[model samples]
Target: MPVLAQDAPIRVGGTLPLTGPLAGVGAIHKLAAEVFVERVNARGGILGRKLEYVLLDDQSQPANARTLYERLVTADNVDLLMGPYGTSSIIAAMGVAQRYNKLLVQSSLGDPSLAPYDMQFPALPIGAEPQITDTEVLLDAYAGMATPPKTIAFVTSKFPSALTIAKGGQEVAAARGLETVLSLEYEFGTKDLGAIANRIKAADPDILWSGAVGMEAVQLLDAMARIEYKPKRHFYLFPAPGPTAAHPHAEGLTTLTWFEEHEPFLANAGAADFVAAYNERAKAVGFPYPHAEYQAAAEYAAWQILAAAAEGAGKLDDAAMAEWLRANTVQTALGPRTFEGKFNAGKASTKLKQVQNKQWVTVWPADLRPSGSQFVAP
Candidate 1:
């Protein structure tokens, strides 16, 4: 029997929500991957083999994700897997990848529970310490204030992302001797934030924390405007301020960010160039890309993984590639990364940012601050 040729240019497949409730967030990351593949192919492909990305729309459905991933691995014979953008979708895909012993590179999924899994690859750099614990940092800052915000509100939707952030935030508040005057959970995509906004205004929280989506972020801002109630401060996650067109309301709102906009790591080198290119592309498309720093950081890291594994394996096959990726240290724009098992145990997550002027200015968590937080209520 003739030996099957190795090093074949094969397919890499996974799930992505190109449309649905979380469509905006999903589309941004999907577009980023598309752009990354385009750049890779333009540069003569990886290891002299043209890379083909096989994307399927999970449509924000977990069941759909399982179905698509099964197709990728069983039917289409994908060389490897890149996980989906959300927590639920990634978890579903991870199950399949492990079952098939296929390598799965994941971006945008931060379940923390998924960290224990073996088949998963942390496509983005891991934090030195858990970045999710940063809510305490903010709470501590409040406690030390001459006068702490007498009333604090914690609001989030029932989505997994919101729940995770709220869980961490609540823990911080509890540890810091701060009281959560109101902790409420709304259904995802609830447009009528008026009641919620009114309740919050009546309570008069010193700090208004929003653990919701970009649309909800906009809804909160709109409702606040209508009710003429603005908290002295607002903290947010997920619906990052200033990064989207909805940024009008998010202006000056503070929240945690996955990337630092002007960090030396991101300010100079190939990663910086990538960010500039993404910005240019966003402008050309008439819809500026959301999460430029985060998306750029992820794509740059993915390319690093691909390059390191390709160089190490000296050929392309899912098993060989997975082995190389697990064992090798990939030099990324962030820095040198060595994945400890399936997770990158070496990297640290950066702190949060506040939207000032018209840009995301890094603040909090001490290490990656570009400038002192200048978040004053407008």
Candidate 2:
């Protein structure tokens, strides 16, 4: 029950999984928001007031996120609201934001379809919709190969985010005339990846896709290797960063994401400034400063959106900000984007990348594609 001071600051609030499974992600999001606050305040603050972000630790639990969000709006009285990381946490917080009608801006919650949630939960989610460009790029990349994969297998986790990704992939695959050889669902943290991998090998699919998170992606890869079953292309929705999946057997490992480093040309110096300031503060407190971390960049972009909308609206009211979202486009670090009623109303920001030669190389989204970064087969 932390208390907010009766100070003149544009107080924003959200939940983060700061102490549980997703603590690393939560820490990055918090770092981004804090860095944004520091940078903005240094530039005379927002509307003559410092921006204050009140992030609560939801412990990577949706139930805790919902309650904390309720407390954020009802008890803490946050002036503006933001969504938490991951789909389930965001979904849980969305209802709370809607109940209060706060201008809810989202960053990392990457389900392209907010329509179903609108119908099911009946909340007006007002913010930039995540551009889910990775799935299509994935299917198309596979389709372009000399001998395109005709059969696909979906190895998915039961997490809402994973399910959403799996569903989106299935729809895209079906449209592309690819047959579903096997669609397997496993619970996250289930110690049965070997069994799932065995099933996948038995199915003998051409392309293998997994909608699991972090270490699960590695586990699946390990299982596939142990069984000596390799697909033409293995698309993992979430991957642990670095060269962990770049070994010979892991050659074809892939993931569609906007979470990678933004091209140098597209990089925003303002974002860099935030990083500089963030690093300074982190160094002072002995906290690690994640430089150029994609998740942090995305959350920082959300703060930029809020600042632009608040300035454009010339008020702190949610509806006023909503109006601003309707009319104005903001040049975020990611790119030029406008809110298409809580969605990316423009081109998607996602790209397909693969682990090649122990490095993550961008292979799709024609504008960002690099030389020799071909969508080479697995």
Candidate 3:
């Protein structure tokens, strides 16, 4: 009953945590979606149908997402949908889409348990397979180190997505001959990470992997700094796209990412232009994150992929659009990608990135794009 509408528009609906624990990233996700919708509609809507994205606030609660998704599909009868910001919310959204047999594209989900519904496309390059790391390209970074870290520790959040990644990392790291010195999962919104940091420092692993989101990461990072618990190397998710990278404690920190600049695959594509557009608007609005942080490129790529599918289908038929996507790869801001399972296939798949001199730079896969800095070995 509580929603926004546009007359005769091709309604694209979703749920995001506009307020709550995930509010920071949720706002960026919503902006990226709206930017894509706005751009597509400005250029004569998808398949000549104006896009009206009606996003409901899930309040960062999976249960709220369940109810909100039902409203989008059953009551509002939106034409298409996009998944919400995190794993649980996305799973909730997927359920609603599957029930209605509606076409849905998702971003920001990486739990292996939910990967079984491969029916819903994922917007990231991660898999839920047992013993499979979130992004092996990153672990390869560790293995390739001249004096590679021999021991690794995982400090993670209790969230399902982080848990899956940590589990996979533990398996993969052990297989890679790295000792698992310590593995700890902290409750979300943990106020003080003193004990966690102390434990990791005591373990004194050469490598530390953080499974915390942006806020949780800050807690752990701050505590690490307080205790001077800098591991030989540190990699984390979240806070990858925000000002946290500039934090003094984040110097030489590393994380895996989906996008950067001068990707040969997208050298002459419209990807740069799309990024520029989002960057300009975001900067104007005083948004601190770049395109990478907000996932603007990937989300816009999803829109581009969906639009191409709609044009290929030549009507508002969800099945036709889905079939087209399965059979062909489309050029998106992310690069040429096909829904070959959970993630879209692309050349610049993932990057091992590090913070050097307060800037995030790529350090591996050597060819994706030069980080213009050497890997600061720990």
Candidate 4:
């Protein structure tokens, strides 16, 4: 049996959307997190101090994030703060971290604007640089199509993250000499995609781009199929339909996402083990894991840094641990990363993913592509 540390406990607090519209993704995060904490505790804790994590469900609400953060920092008096599952929640909790001077180790917040937080470091191996670079790469690749996709459309929900993605797409489209025939933003929980579908058809865009959540995306894709409106290509943003949901509507679709399993890692590292563990853990929860490599990679990397910091401090002092983390260089599935320090401190890598025969396949960055683009029959 493992002995418990009696000196002092290192308490880490986190917020996740365990129950909400985005629960599918949130659930995956929770499972991975649970295992991470369990594994750390099993190893006799960190630095002779037990690592305790207090996880709360933010219900995917930005407002709830604010309340939960205050409760954790003020009432619970956690040693440190960790970033949340979604961008909004993390953004909401960030102010509290700043005010409290707690270090925020990031996991899923990808918005480049959030990079400015000096005390915060994303667990994600990549950042906004990829989103911007990849969007341009995607547009350029589309332009090279035998029959250039002259007209493009971009759609997203009112969420700030989705809006940021859509905005990036618009910029890329403009640079590539592609006309954005349609750009629309809808409020959350919108039940109607009929009008949106009609507009896309009217514009006759060769490519259709969307930054929608999983459920909303399912509805929109179904509507497109119902109308039998198949553009030359379809590009989707993060957390969109995966193979299971995407295949039916996205049979001939081309989308960009944050993860590509087949991509050749510059350093093989522990990717195989990570994927296997992640898949097994995900299967236990009855849902195939979310495909974003960044999420899992970040989670793994965050824990690595935390362990390093804990060992360096040899105790659980918040200020001491935070300082240790900033000074340590951590290994990630992507590669070795050193904290360049945050000032919108952006540094990262990205690979493109496309749907091929109802399967998500890596297709860009040359060296990492599985086979190549599977241009659908238009």
lDDT of 2 by residue, 244-322 (tens): 3445566757776553454652366365565566556655654433244456667777888888888888888788877
lDDT of 3 by residue, 1-378 (tens): 643443367888888888987877777777777778777778888766688888899998889999999998889888888778887888888887788887777777766457455346655545435236453666787666678788889888877778877888888888878899999998865768899999998998888888877567667788888987677778886653565676678888888766665455345246666667777777777776554542656566667766787888887778888788788877766666667643432223666777776666777767654635577765
Write candidate 1's Cα lDDT for 158-188 as tens digits.
Answer: 7675677787777777666667888888987
Candidate lDDT values, in order: 0.68, 0.69, 0.72, 0.67
Q: Which candidate leads in TM-score?
A: 3
Candidate 1 lDDT score at position 2: 62
- CA-only RMSD, every prediction: 3.5, 4.7, 3.4, 3.3
Q: lDDT rank, highest first? A: 3, 2, 1, 4
How many backbone clashes can be found in candidate 2?
2
TM-score of each: 0.86, 0.83, 0.91, 0.86
What total of clashing residue pairs does each candidate reach? 5, 2, 1, 2
Query: Residue pairs in steric clash, candidate 3?
Result: 112-128
C-alpha displacement of 122 in model 2, angstroms? 16
- In Å, residue 22's CA in model 4 sits off its true spot by 1.4
Residue ranges of candidate 1 with Cα displaced over 4 Å: 1-8, 126-132, 140-150, 240-246, 267-269, 289-291, 317-320, 341-347, 365-378
